[model samples]
Target chain A: MSIRDLARHLDISIGTVSRALNGKSDVNPETRERVLAAAKKLGYVPNQSGRSLRQGTTNTIGFMIESTIETADNGGSFFMPVFEGVQSVFRRHHLDLVALLCGTDEDPSAYLNRVVGRRFVDGLIISATTRNDPRITFLLDRKIPFVALGRSATGGAYPWIDLDFEGVAATAVTRLVNFGHNRIAIGVPASDINLGYVFQDGYKHALAANGIPFDPALVLPAHSNEEGGYQVASAMLAQKHMPTAVILVNENMAIGLYRRFYEAGIHPGRDIAVIGFRESTQSRFLSPTLTCFRISLRDLGIKLAEALLSTMPAFRNNYPQERVELIWPMELVPGESDVLKRTA
Target chain B: MSIRDLARHLDISIGTVSRALNGKSDVNPETRERVLAAAKKLGYVPNQSGRSLRQGTTNTIGFMIESTIETADNGGSFFMPVFEGVQSVFRRHHLDLVALLCGTDEDPSAYLNRVVGRRFVDGLIISATTRNDPRITFLLDRKIPFVALGRSATGGAYPWIDLDFEGVAATAVTRLVNFGHNRIAIGVPASDINLGYVFQDGYKHALAANGIPFDPALVLPAHSNEEGGYQVASAMLAQKHMPTAVILVNENMAIGLYRRFYEAGIHPGRDIAVIGFRESTQSRFLSPTLTCFRISLRDLGIKLAEALLSTMPAFRNNYPQERVELIWPMELVPGESDVLKRTA
Candidate 1:
């Protein structure tokens, strides 16, 4: 029902009816009550465009993610739990969470600009950060309240929560080294995503610490999915010397890696040791269970929400903090996939 | 920049500036061109709230999905491709697609009311429809343009595109019966989701066709995830007489079923035949590859977009149809999981 209709029914001015509906103090209590009663009885829903224009807030938060072939393969599994966690916190504050998916055809920066320009949300949580993400710079310049799910080298004092890819790689290398494996290979994303650089750097640093020279040939770059995992295994086989053990940055890749190895009669735990990035449903069900890192995705999401809220002026008091930069830690889950012992 | 700022800079009244910016016919052509150039140069992003309030359209579409624990287990993999397809179509019309996640704490009908009340989108695509959904009635009452990804028992002249769950059940049952298995079990969702009822109906009809009596004991209900699949296997082992063949309604359940069977020393392809509902990444890598149904999610998404657009007045001409009620088809991908033959 329109404001005019509500006003006509109440025998009052449309301004009075609108003021009463919006909880303005100018309207008398008895008249305000009558307007509200009639409006509720008549099922009047306030126009959000009108309300937002006046209040400058939509009571909504956006979580931006990319929709790509690689994302379609396994990104959903990674983000679903996080979305749930973010929503769980938002629900308490009567805020809604909407996911803004950046299509493959659109550049991430352009998508961010469109969304921000529209004032579609009060805050944002952007994931899959690149080495020098333009979206970060755009958001920073706009003074928009946002949190990055991963780190970027964009030179900003913005909050971000990144997974400890460096630590994961280093731990994997140390574990494999303790088993007396001299030749070790690592699988990382071929893209310019910031995590890949951190992961490879950790691998190189660990190699140096173990007194083993870094071999460029031992580093394999591909998409971070099952297909990429299969390609990594194929590339290893074609190499001049195959590594005794390998580390994968994505758990989904383990499926393809196993499939390729299975076809060649090279079982992961028996023929060659393997360490996967994170524990997942598929990883748990793999024949020789995948030895991977585990993290509470839901908790990570909760922290992400708090971090974002801490930056926004409206909710900053509730989540008071100096800064929210953090490297989320993961625990190692031992399994048969990395049980192979190598002779020195 | 605000309209006032633009007007001041251009030495024009706010009303003239607004008219020129909105391309109103009353504005002189020269003034309109001058305002447009200055607006562009000054990086003036037209306030969407103001624009939408005047136009009565948001140029946005909402895809409503649930964020339940069961959804977290596997829903992301199912929706990402569909989002891509829907965005692909929306991108052509310059319409933005945002995913509205209904949290577990709030009732879906209530959530829909708030979103619709806010006039958030021009159209909507709602998924995971339940039997006799209240959201359908609410939307119908509000005269909102929407399409359902799954069908509902809710009596309404609304468009929906649902999977052929009944056909999948019948096909699986027929194939298992042809393998000389008199007793067959089916795993279905324990919830009141419409698909569960449809799937069971197909199973019953198929049994009758084979001259077999309906056995309530053979139908097992659980969540449509890996944990549910494991429970189904556990329930089967506890039965007085285990069915020789079993069909699952979700491919994700295969992981749990396989794990359970492994612990119980009952091989799926050898000891008992199994037919999974849909083919997925997990299904492909399954030791004894899962015999499951396959459907192109991207195509399904494209159809869903077309169906929703057909119902919307602005885009109806482009996707003209009397109605969009359709049962999306699936093809069986033969695998070793259900290859067991029983000698009667």
Candidate 2:
């Protein structure tokens, strides 16, 4: 049923019905109830375009990700919790999220041409930003509001919420060293993705701080997946001189490493030590609980929502201080997989 | 940089710069080159709002979830692949996704009201449909295009895609019975959610098909989670007459059950045969592996997207054969966790 039908049934002007439904104070209480009852009975719902045209804001935020790369890379499972966290805050704030999936193959200009040119969204939350990303430049040039999930390596230039990868890696490395493991290896992705770089840098710095010169041979770069981890670990184990301990960049890789070690007749926590990143729900129940870096994927989502809600203009336009860097610290969860001395 | 600046720099009209950037006709070939070169040099991008205002369609779809209940329950991890699948199609179609997280506490009517009333989206995809859902009625009443991920129990009244829970459960139970297991138990959620009912129905039908009378004593209904599985399994084992095989409704619960079995000095494959639904990426790698149903969360996402995209106003207005059920079949992976030999 249309608003006109509700108005006719309530014996009121269409304007009166519209005002009452819009929650405007001009409508009388009794008349408003009458209109509402009629509308509910007839299943009349309002249209957003008309409201948006009148109100000038949709009260909705848009979340954009590079779709092709995301699926190909299989990042959805890892990134799901972050989306949940973002949704939590958006629900609390009565804000709606509009998720947009774009491709890197598309003229980077297409994202702006669609999101900004069309004015489809009030703000944007972008994930998996790369160095010299044209999307960042487009958003900045247009003065559109947006927030990045990862920081650019060049400097603290963009408004982002990131995990302290360096800190987490250092802690894991230190724990391994304290357990009397000197020959240590670090496994990470070979891609130019920002997270990969952050993890690799952290692993390098941690080794340096421990008075151990970085060994190029010990640094293994794979595809950031289980099979990649398995292949890398297996090859490393087959080498004449093998590292006693390894620091894996993510949980999937770590799980793969564990399986490979088991197949090679090497038991984790006994013959070799393993430390990894990102604590998952299933980690605790594994045959040997994984010792890793724990970051709240949900909490990251909340921060991203807050960043988008702040409506901060893109980095180049906003003042340096206005460009916030909200970095969440990572904590190390020591599990049976790591052979560390008991403090107690 | 604005298109006007790039136009002046390239000695071209603002229209040529815009068309060139949009990859549209009505522009000379070399002039398009000059405009593109200048735009690239100047980092000029077109405005999306102005373009969308003229074009009418946003080339975007909306995905809404009951964020409050979903986050509180599963933390939204289960829906990631579904989103990824939708995203895969969106990328190919050059369409974007706008995600919204609605709450259950709020009037369910508000969800359809905001989407339909605002005309903020072209189509919608929703997950976790409840019985007697007002949102469904509103969408139906408004003739708004939408698709649900899970089917409603009231038969095919709406377009939806769901796993063949009954088929999978029946197969699992039959497998257990054929393995010479007379005392078998089914563990599922005690919640009022639609999945709980679907799972229970499957379990009951499976037993009935096997000529075994359904036993309430062996049906354990707890929360659908790891902790719930652990608790339920422990309680079942404590009974004077314990079931030989247990079929869990979900993978997380099975993990917990495995833990409990390990603690009780009973190996999963050796002492207590176990079968459950598999959802995690690492499930196959579990010790002795796991005998469970595998459904592609990503494929489900894609199906939901297809259903939403196919929605038409006629279907919305006349309640046109809106019910579309796509049942994803299950495949059994032989694992050491269920090593019982077939008796029949």
Candidate 3:
């Protein structure tokens, strides 16, 4: 009937049963299993059998997402896995995760300020950070425990977890160069986000390391979605010295790139090699399959939550040593799209 | 500096400026453009320039999403457009929408009850309903204003705006039947959800109308995702009848279905006709394109919000004529994947 009933049936103390059910480390694994089996057998749902309002904490964190045209384009994906990762970490503490939408027309700082000012959440996790994000400073001014999913230029000691976009670009470029690709064109986001700059820096450094002159014209600034990828295709093809291989800054762009390649009667793996920045379901479904970088979004999300928890005093004991900055790495998942060997 | 300053500069009334900026219908089109241009020129951020805690309302709506393993494979995309739709209407009411995640292991009813008891949201819009969802009854008993994104057999009049699964199934079955296919397999969720039953009912009715008997073996129930779609492939091939066509219950599953078909050397539109349940960016990007149903998720979301507002005492006037039940329609979108005309 209740947790107490299950505890009595198991002949275990209520505290032990509660710890085991809540995934506390203090409980013995065997005891935890016994407690769980007893609870299941008794049909005891630990959560809401005359539950009281959670004490002190709201037990909720907010993840602010960008609401724009592109989000709807790819079936509104882009953030689901990362969300799952955050939730996994939060659920351990029974902290619920809620998504806050920032409309395309709204000012990010103002929108965020209202949410934080209301103290609707215990902490926050925000993504799509601008190169010089004011929201970071805004959060700090309010002394709100938070984590930015991407790095920001705001000068301060704050918790953050960002994908190693520089490393991804370097690895992608170096791999293509090793395949004898001399004229490698890259498509970066036209947005003034920090990730774009970091990604491009790695790309330029990789090119220079290989003794290849980085042409400004070779870098294409486009939207971060499929349409952005498609818009860059014609210009890429019409270049004076057409690129033999292309490195895309975002994986979602691969969808449009594939469409362009298909329409132009060009084979992705042969006519021109393509390497996407991220590996996504759509990229995996691409005809030639996309050679892209793989970052465990869920893992990144867990790290993000942990990073935020480290900042909060209430959760400091669980998180322990502070992790103020983290540059998460991504690995290569090779596919036919980037397997072209250039003879020239 | 502010909306008032912009209005003063434009020599327009403050009400006109506010209406124009918030996208209210009272403002003249040309005047709205002028107000916008002036606001941009003056660098005015209207919503939160000096906005404070909103009175009379928490000004937040919760959109509960199910966080499960199947969601990750599909990019967790099903609800985004709908979110956008909800936000579009909510923004008009100065209400913000937030996504509430229901953990894979957690009970939905418990989660909903916790959130409601905490008074965290003004209203709720919950999706992925089961046949006899206790959450609906729980919310109703609490006198909470909420909307179900899917239908349920809970034996009460509640504001629900669910997709017409029955119509979708019937239409898909009829189309496949007209393509000269007698043996058709259909995939539905293995979970005891309401849509599964409604969809199957339509499938059975469609078959019966065509004078074909329903075979239990022909009804393949699996997870509602890509992996599930992949799992269904081998079984589909193993069937003694070897269905000439198959209907998928979820669009997200189509991604895996395509991959399995490719690996098995069976072309989707050629070897065996395939019809997916929904049209999305992924479906559009499919090699042969996907023949499926189409509905404006944003519009559906708007309707959902309006329906909820109709039930709420505070927002009842905005949506006077209460709509207790709505079966939203999904029109067919013809694509190459289901164009195989049976010559036999």
Give residue B248's lDDT in candidate 1 (0 to 100): 95
What residue pairs clash in candidate 1, if any at all? Answer: none
TM-score chain B for all models.
0.93, 0.79, 0.82
Q: Please state what fraction of the native interface contacts candidate 2 reproduces.
A: 0.35
Computed on alpha carbons, the lDDT of every model, listed in order, comes to: 0.88, 0.70, 0.79
iRMSD for each candidate structure, in the order shown:
1.7, 4.5, 7.7
Q: DockQ of each model against the real complex?
A: 0.66, 0.35, 0.19
Write model 1 residue lDDT over B9-109, tens digit each, in one string.
99999999988988899999999999999988876777777778888888889999988866777888899999999988888788899999898777988
Q: What is the TM-score of each candidate against the true structure?
A: 0.94, 0.84, 0.82
Residue-by-residue lDDT tens digits, candidate 3, A1-344: 45677788888998999999889999999999998888665445534202222333566789987776655554245577777788888888888899898776778888886676445677898888889999988778757788888898888778888889889888888898899889999898887878889988999999999999989998999887777788777778788888888888877778778778777888788788999877776556556788998878778888888888988887889886766688888889999898864445
Which predicted model would earn the best lDDT?
Answer: 1
Which regions of candidate 3 are displaced past 4 Å? Answer: A1-57, A73-76, A282-285, A341-344, B1-56, B341-344
Please give, for residues B1-344, the per-residue lDDT of candidate 2 as tens digits.
55677777777787777888888887788878877777766655454334444554556677776654333335344655566688766676666776665654455457657665555566778766665466776676666677876666543356877778788788888999899887888887775557767877888888888888888888898766667778778977887999999988777677678878787877788888888776455466565567887777777777676666656542233233445668777677667677854344
Ranking by TM-score: 1, 2, 3
Instruction: Compute the DockQ of candidate 2.
Output: 0.35
- Candidate 1 C-alpha error for residue B47, in Å: 1.4
Query: How well does candidate 3 match the true structure, expressed as C-alpha RMSD?
Result: 9.7
Superposition TM-score, candidate 1 onto the true structure: 0.94
lDDT of 2 by residue, A95-170 (tens): 6665565554555446655566446566778877675566776676666778888777544345788788888888
Return the candidate ranking by DockQ, descending.
1, 2, 3
lDDT of 1 at A275: 97
RMSD of each: 2.6, 5.2, 9.7
Order of all candidates by lDDT, from best down to worst? 1, 3, 2
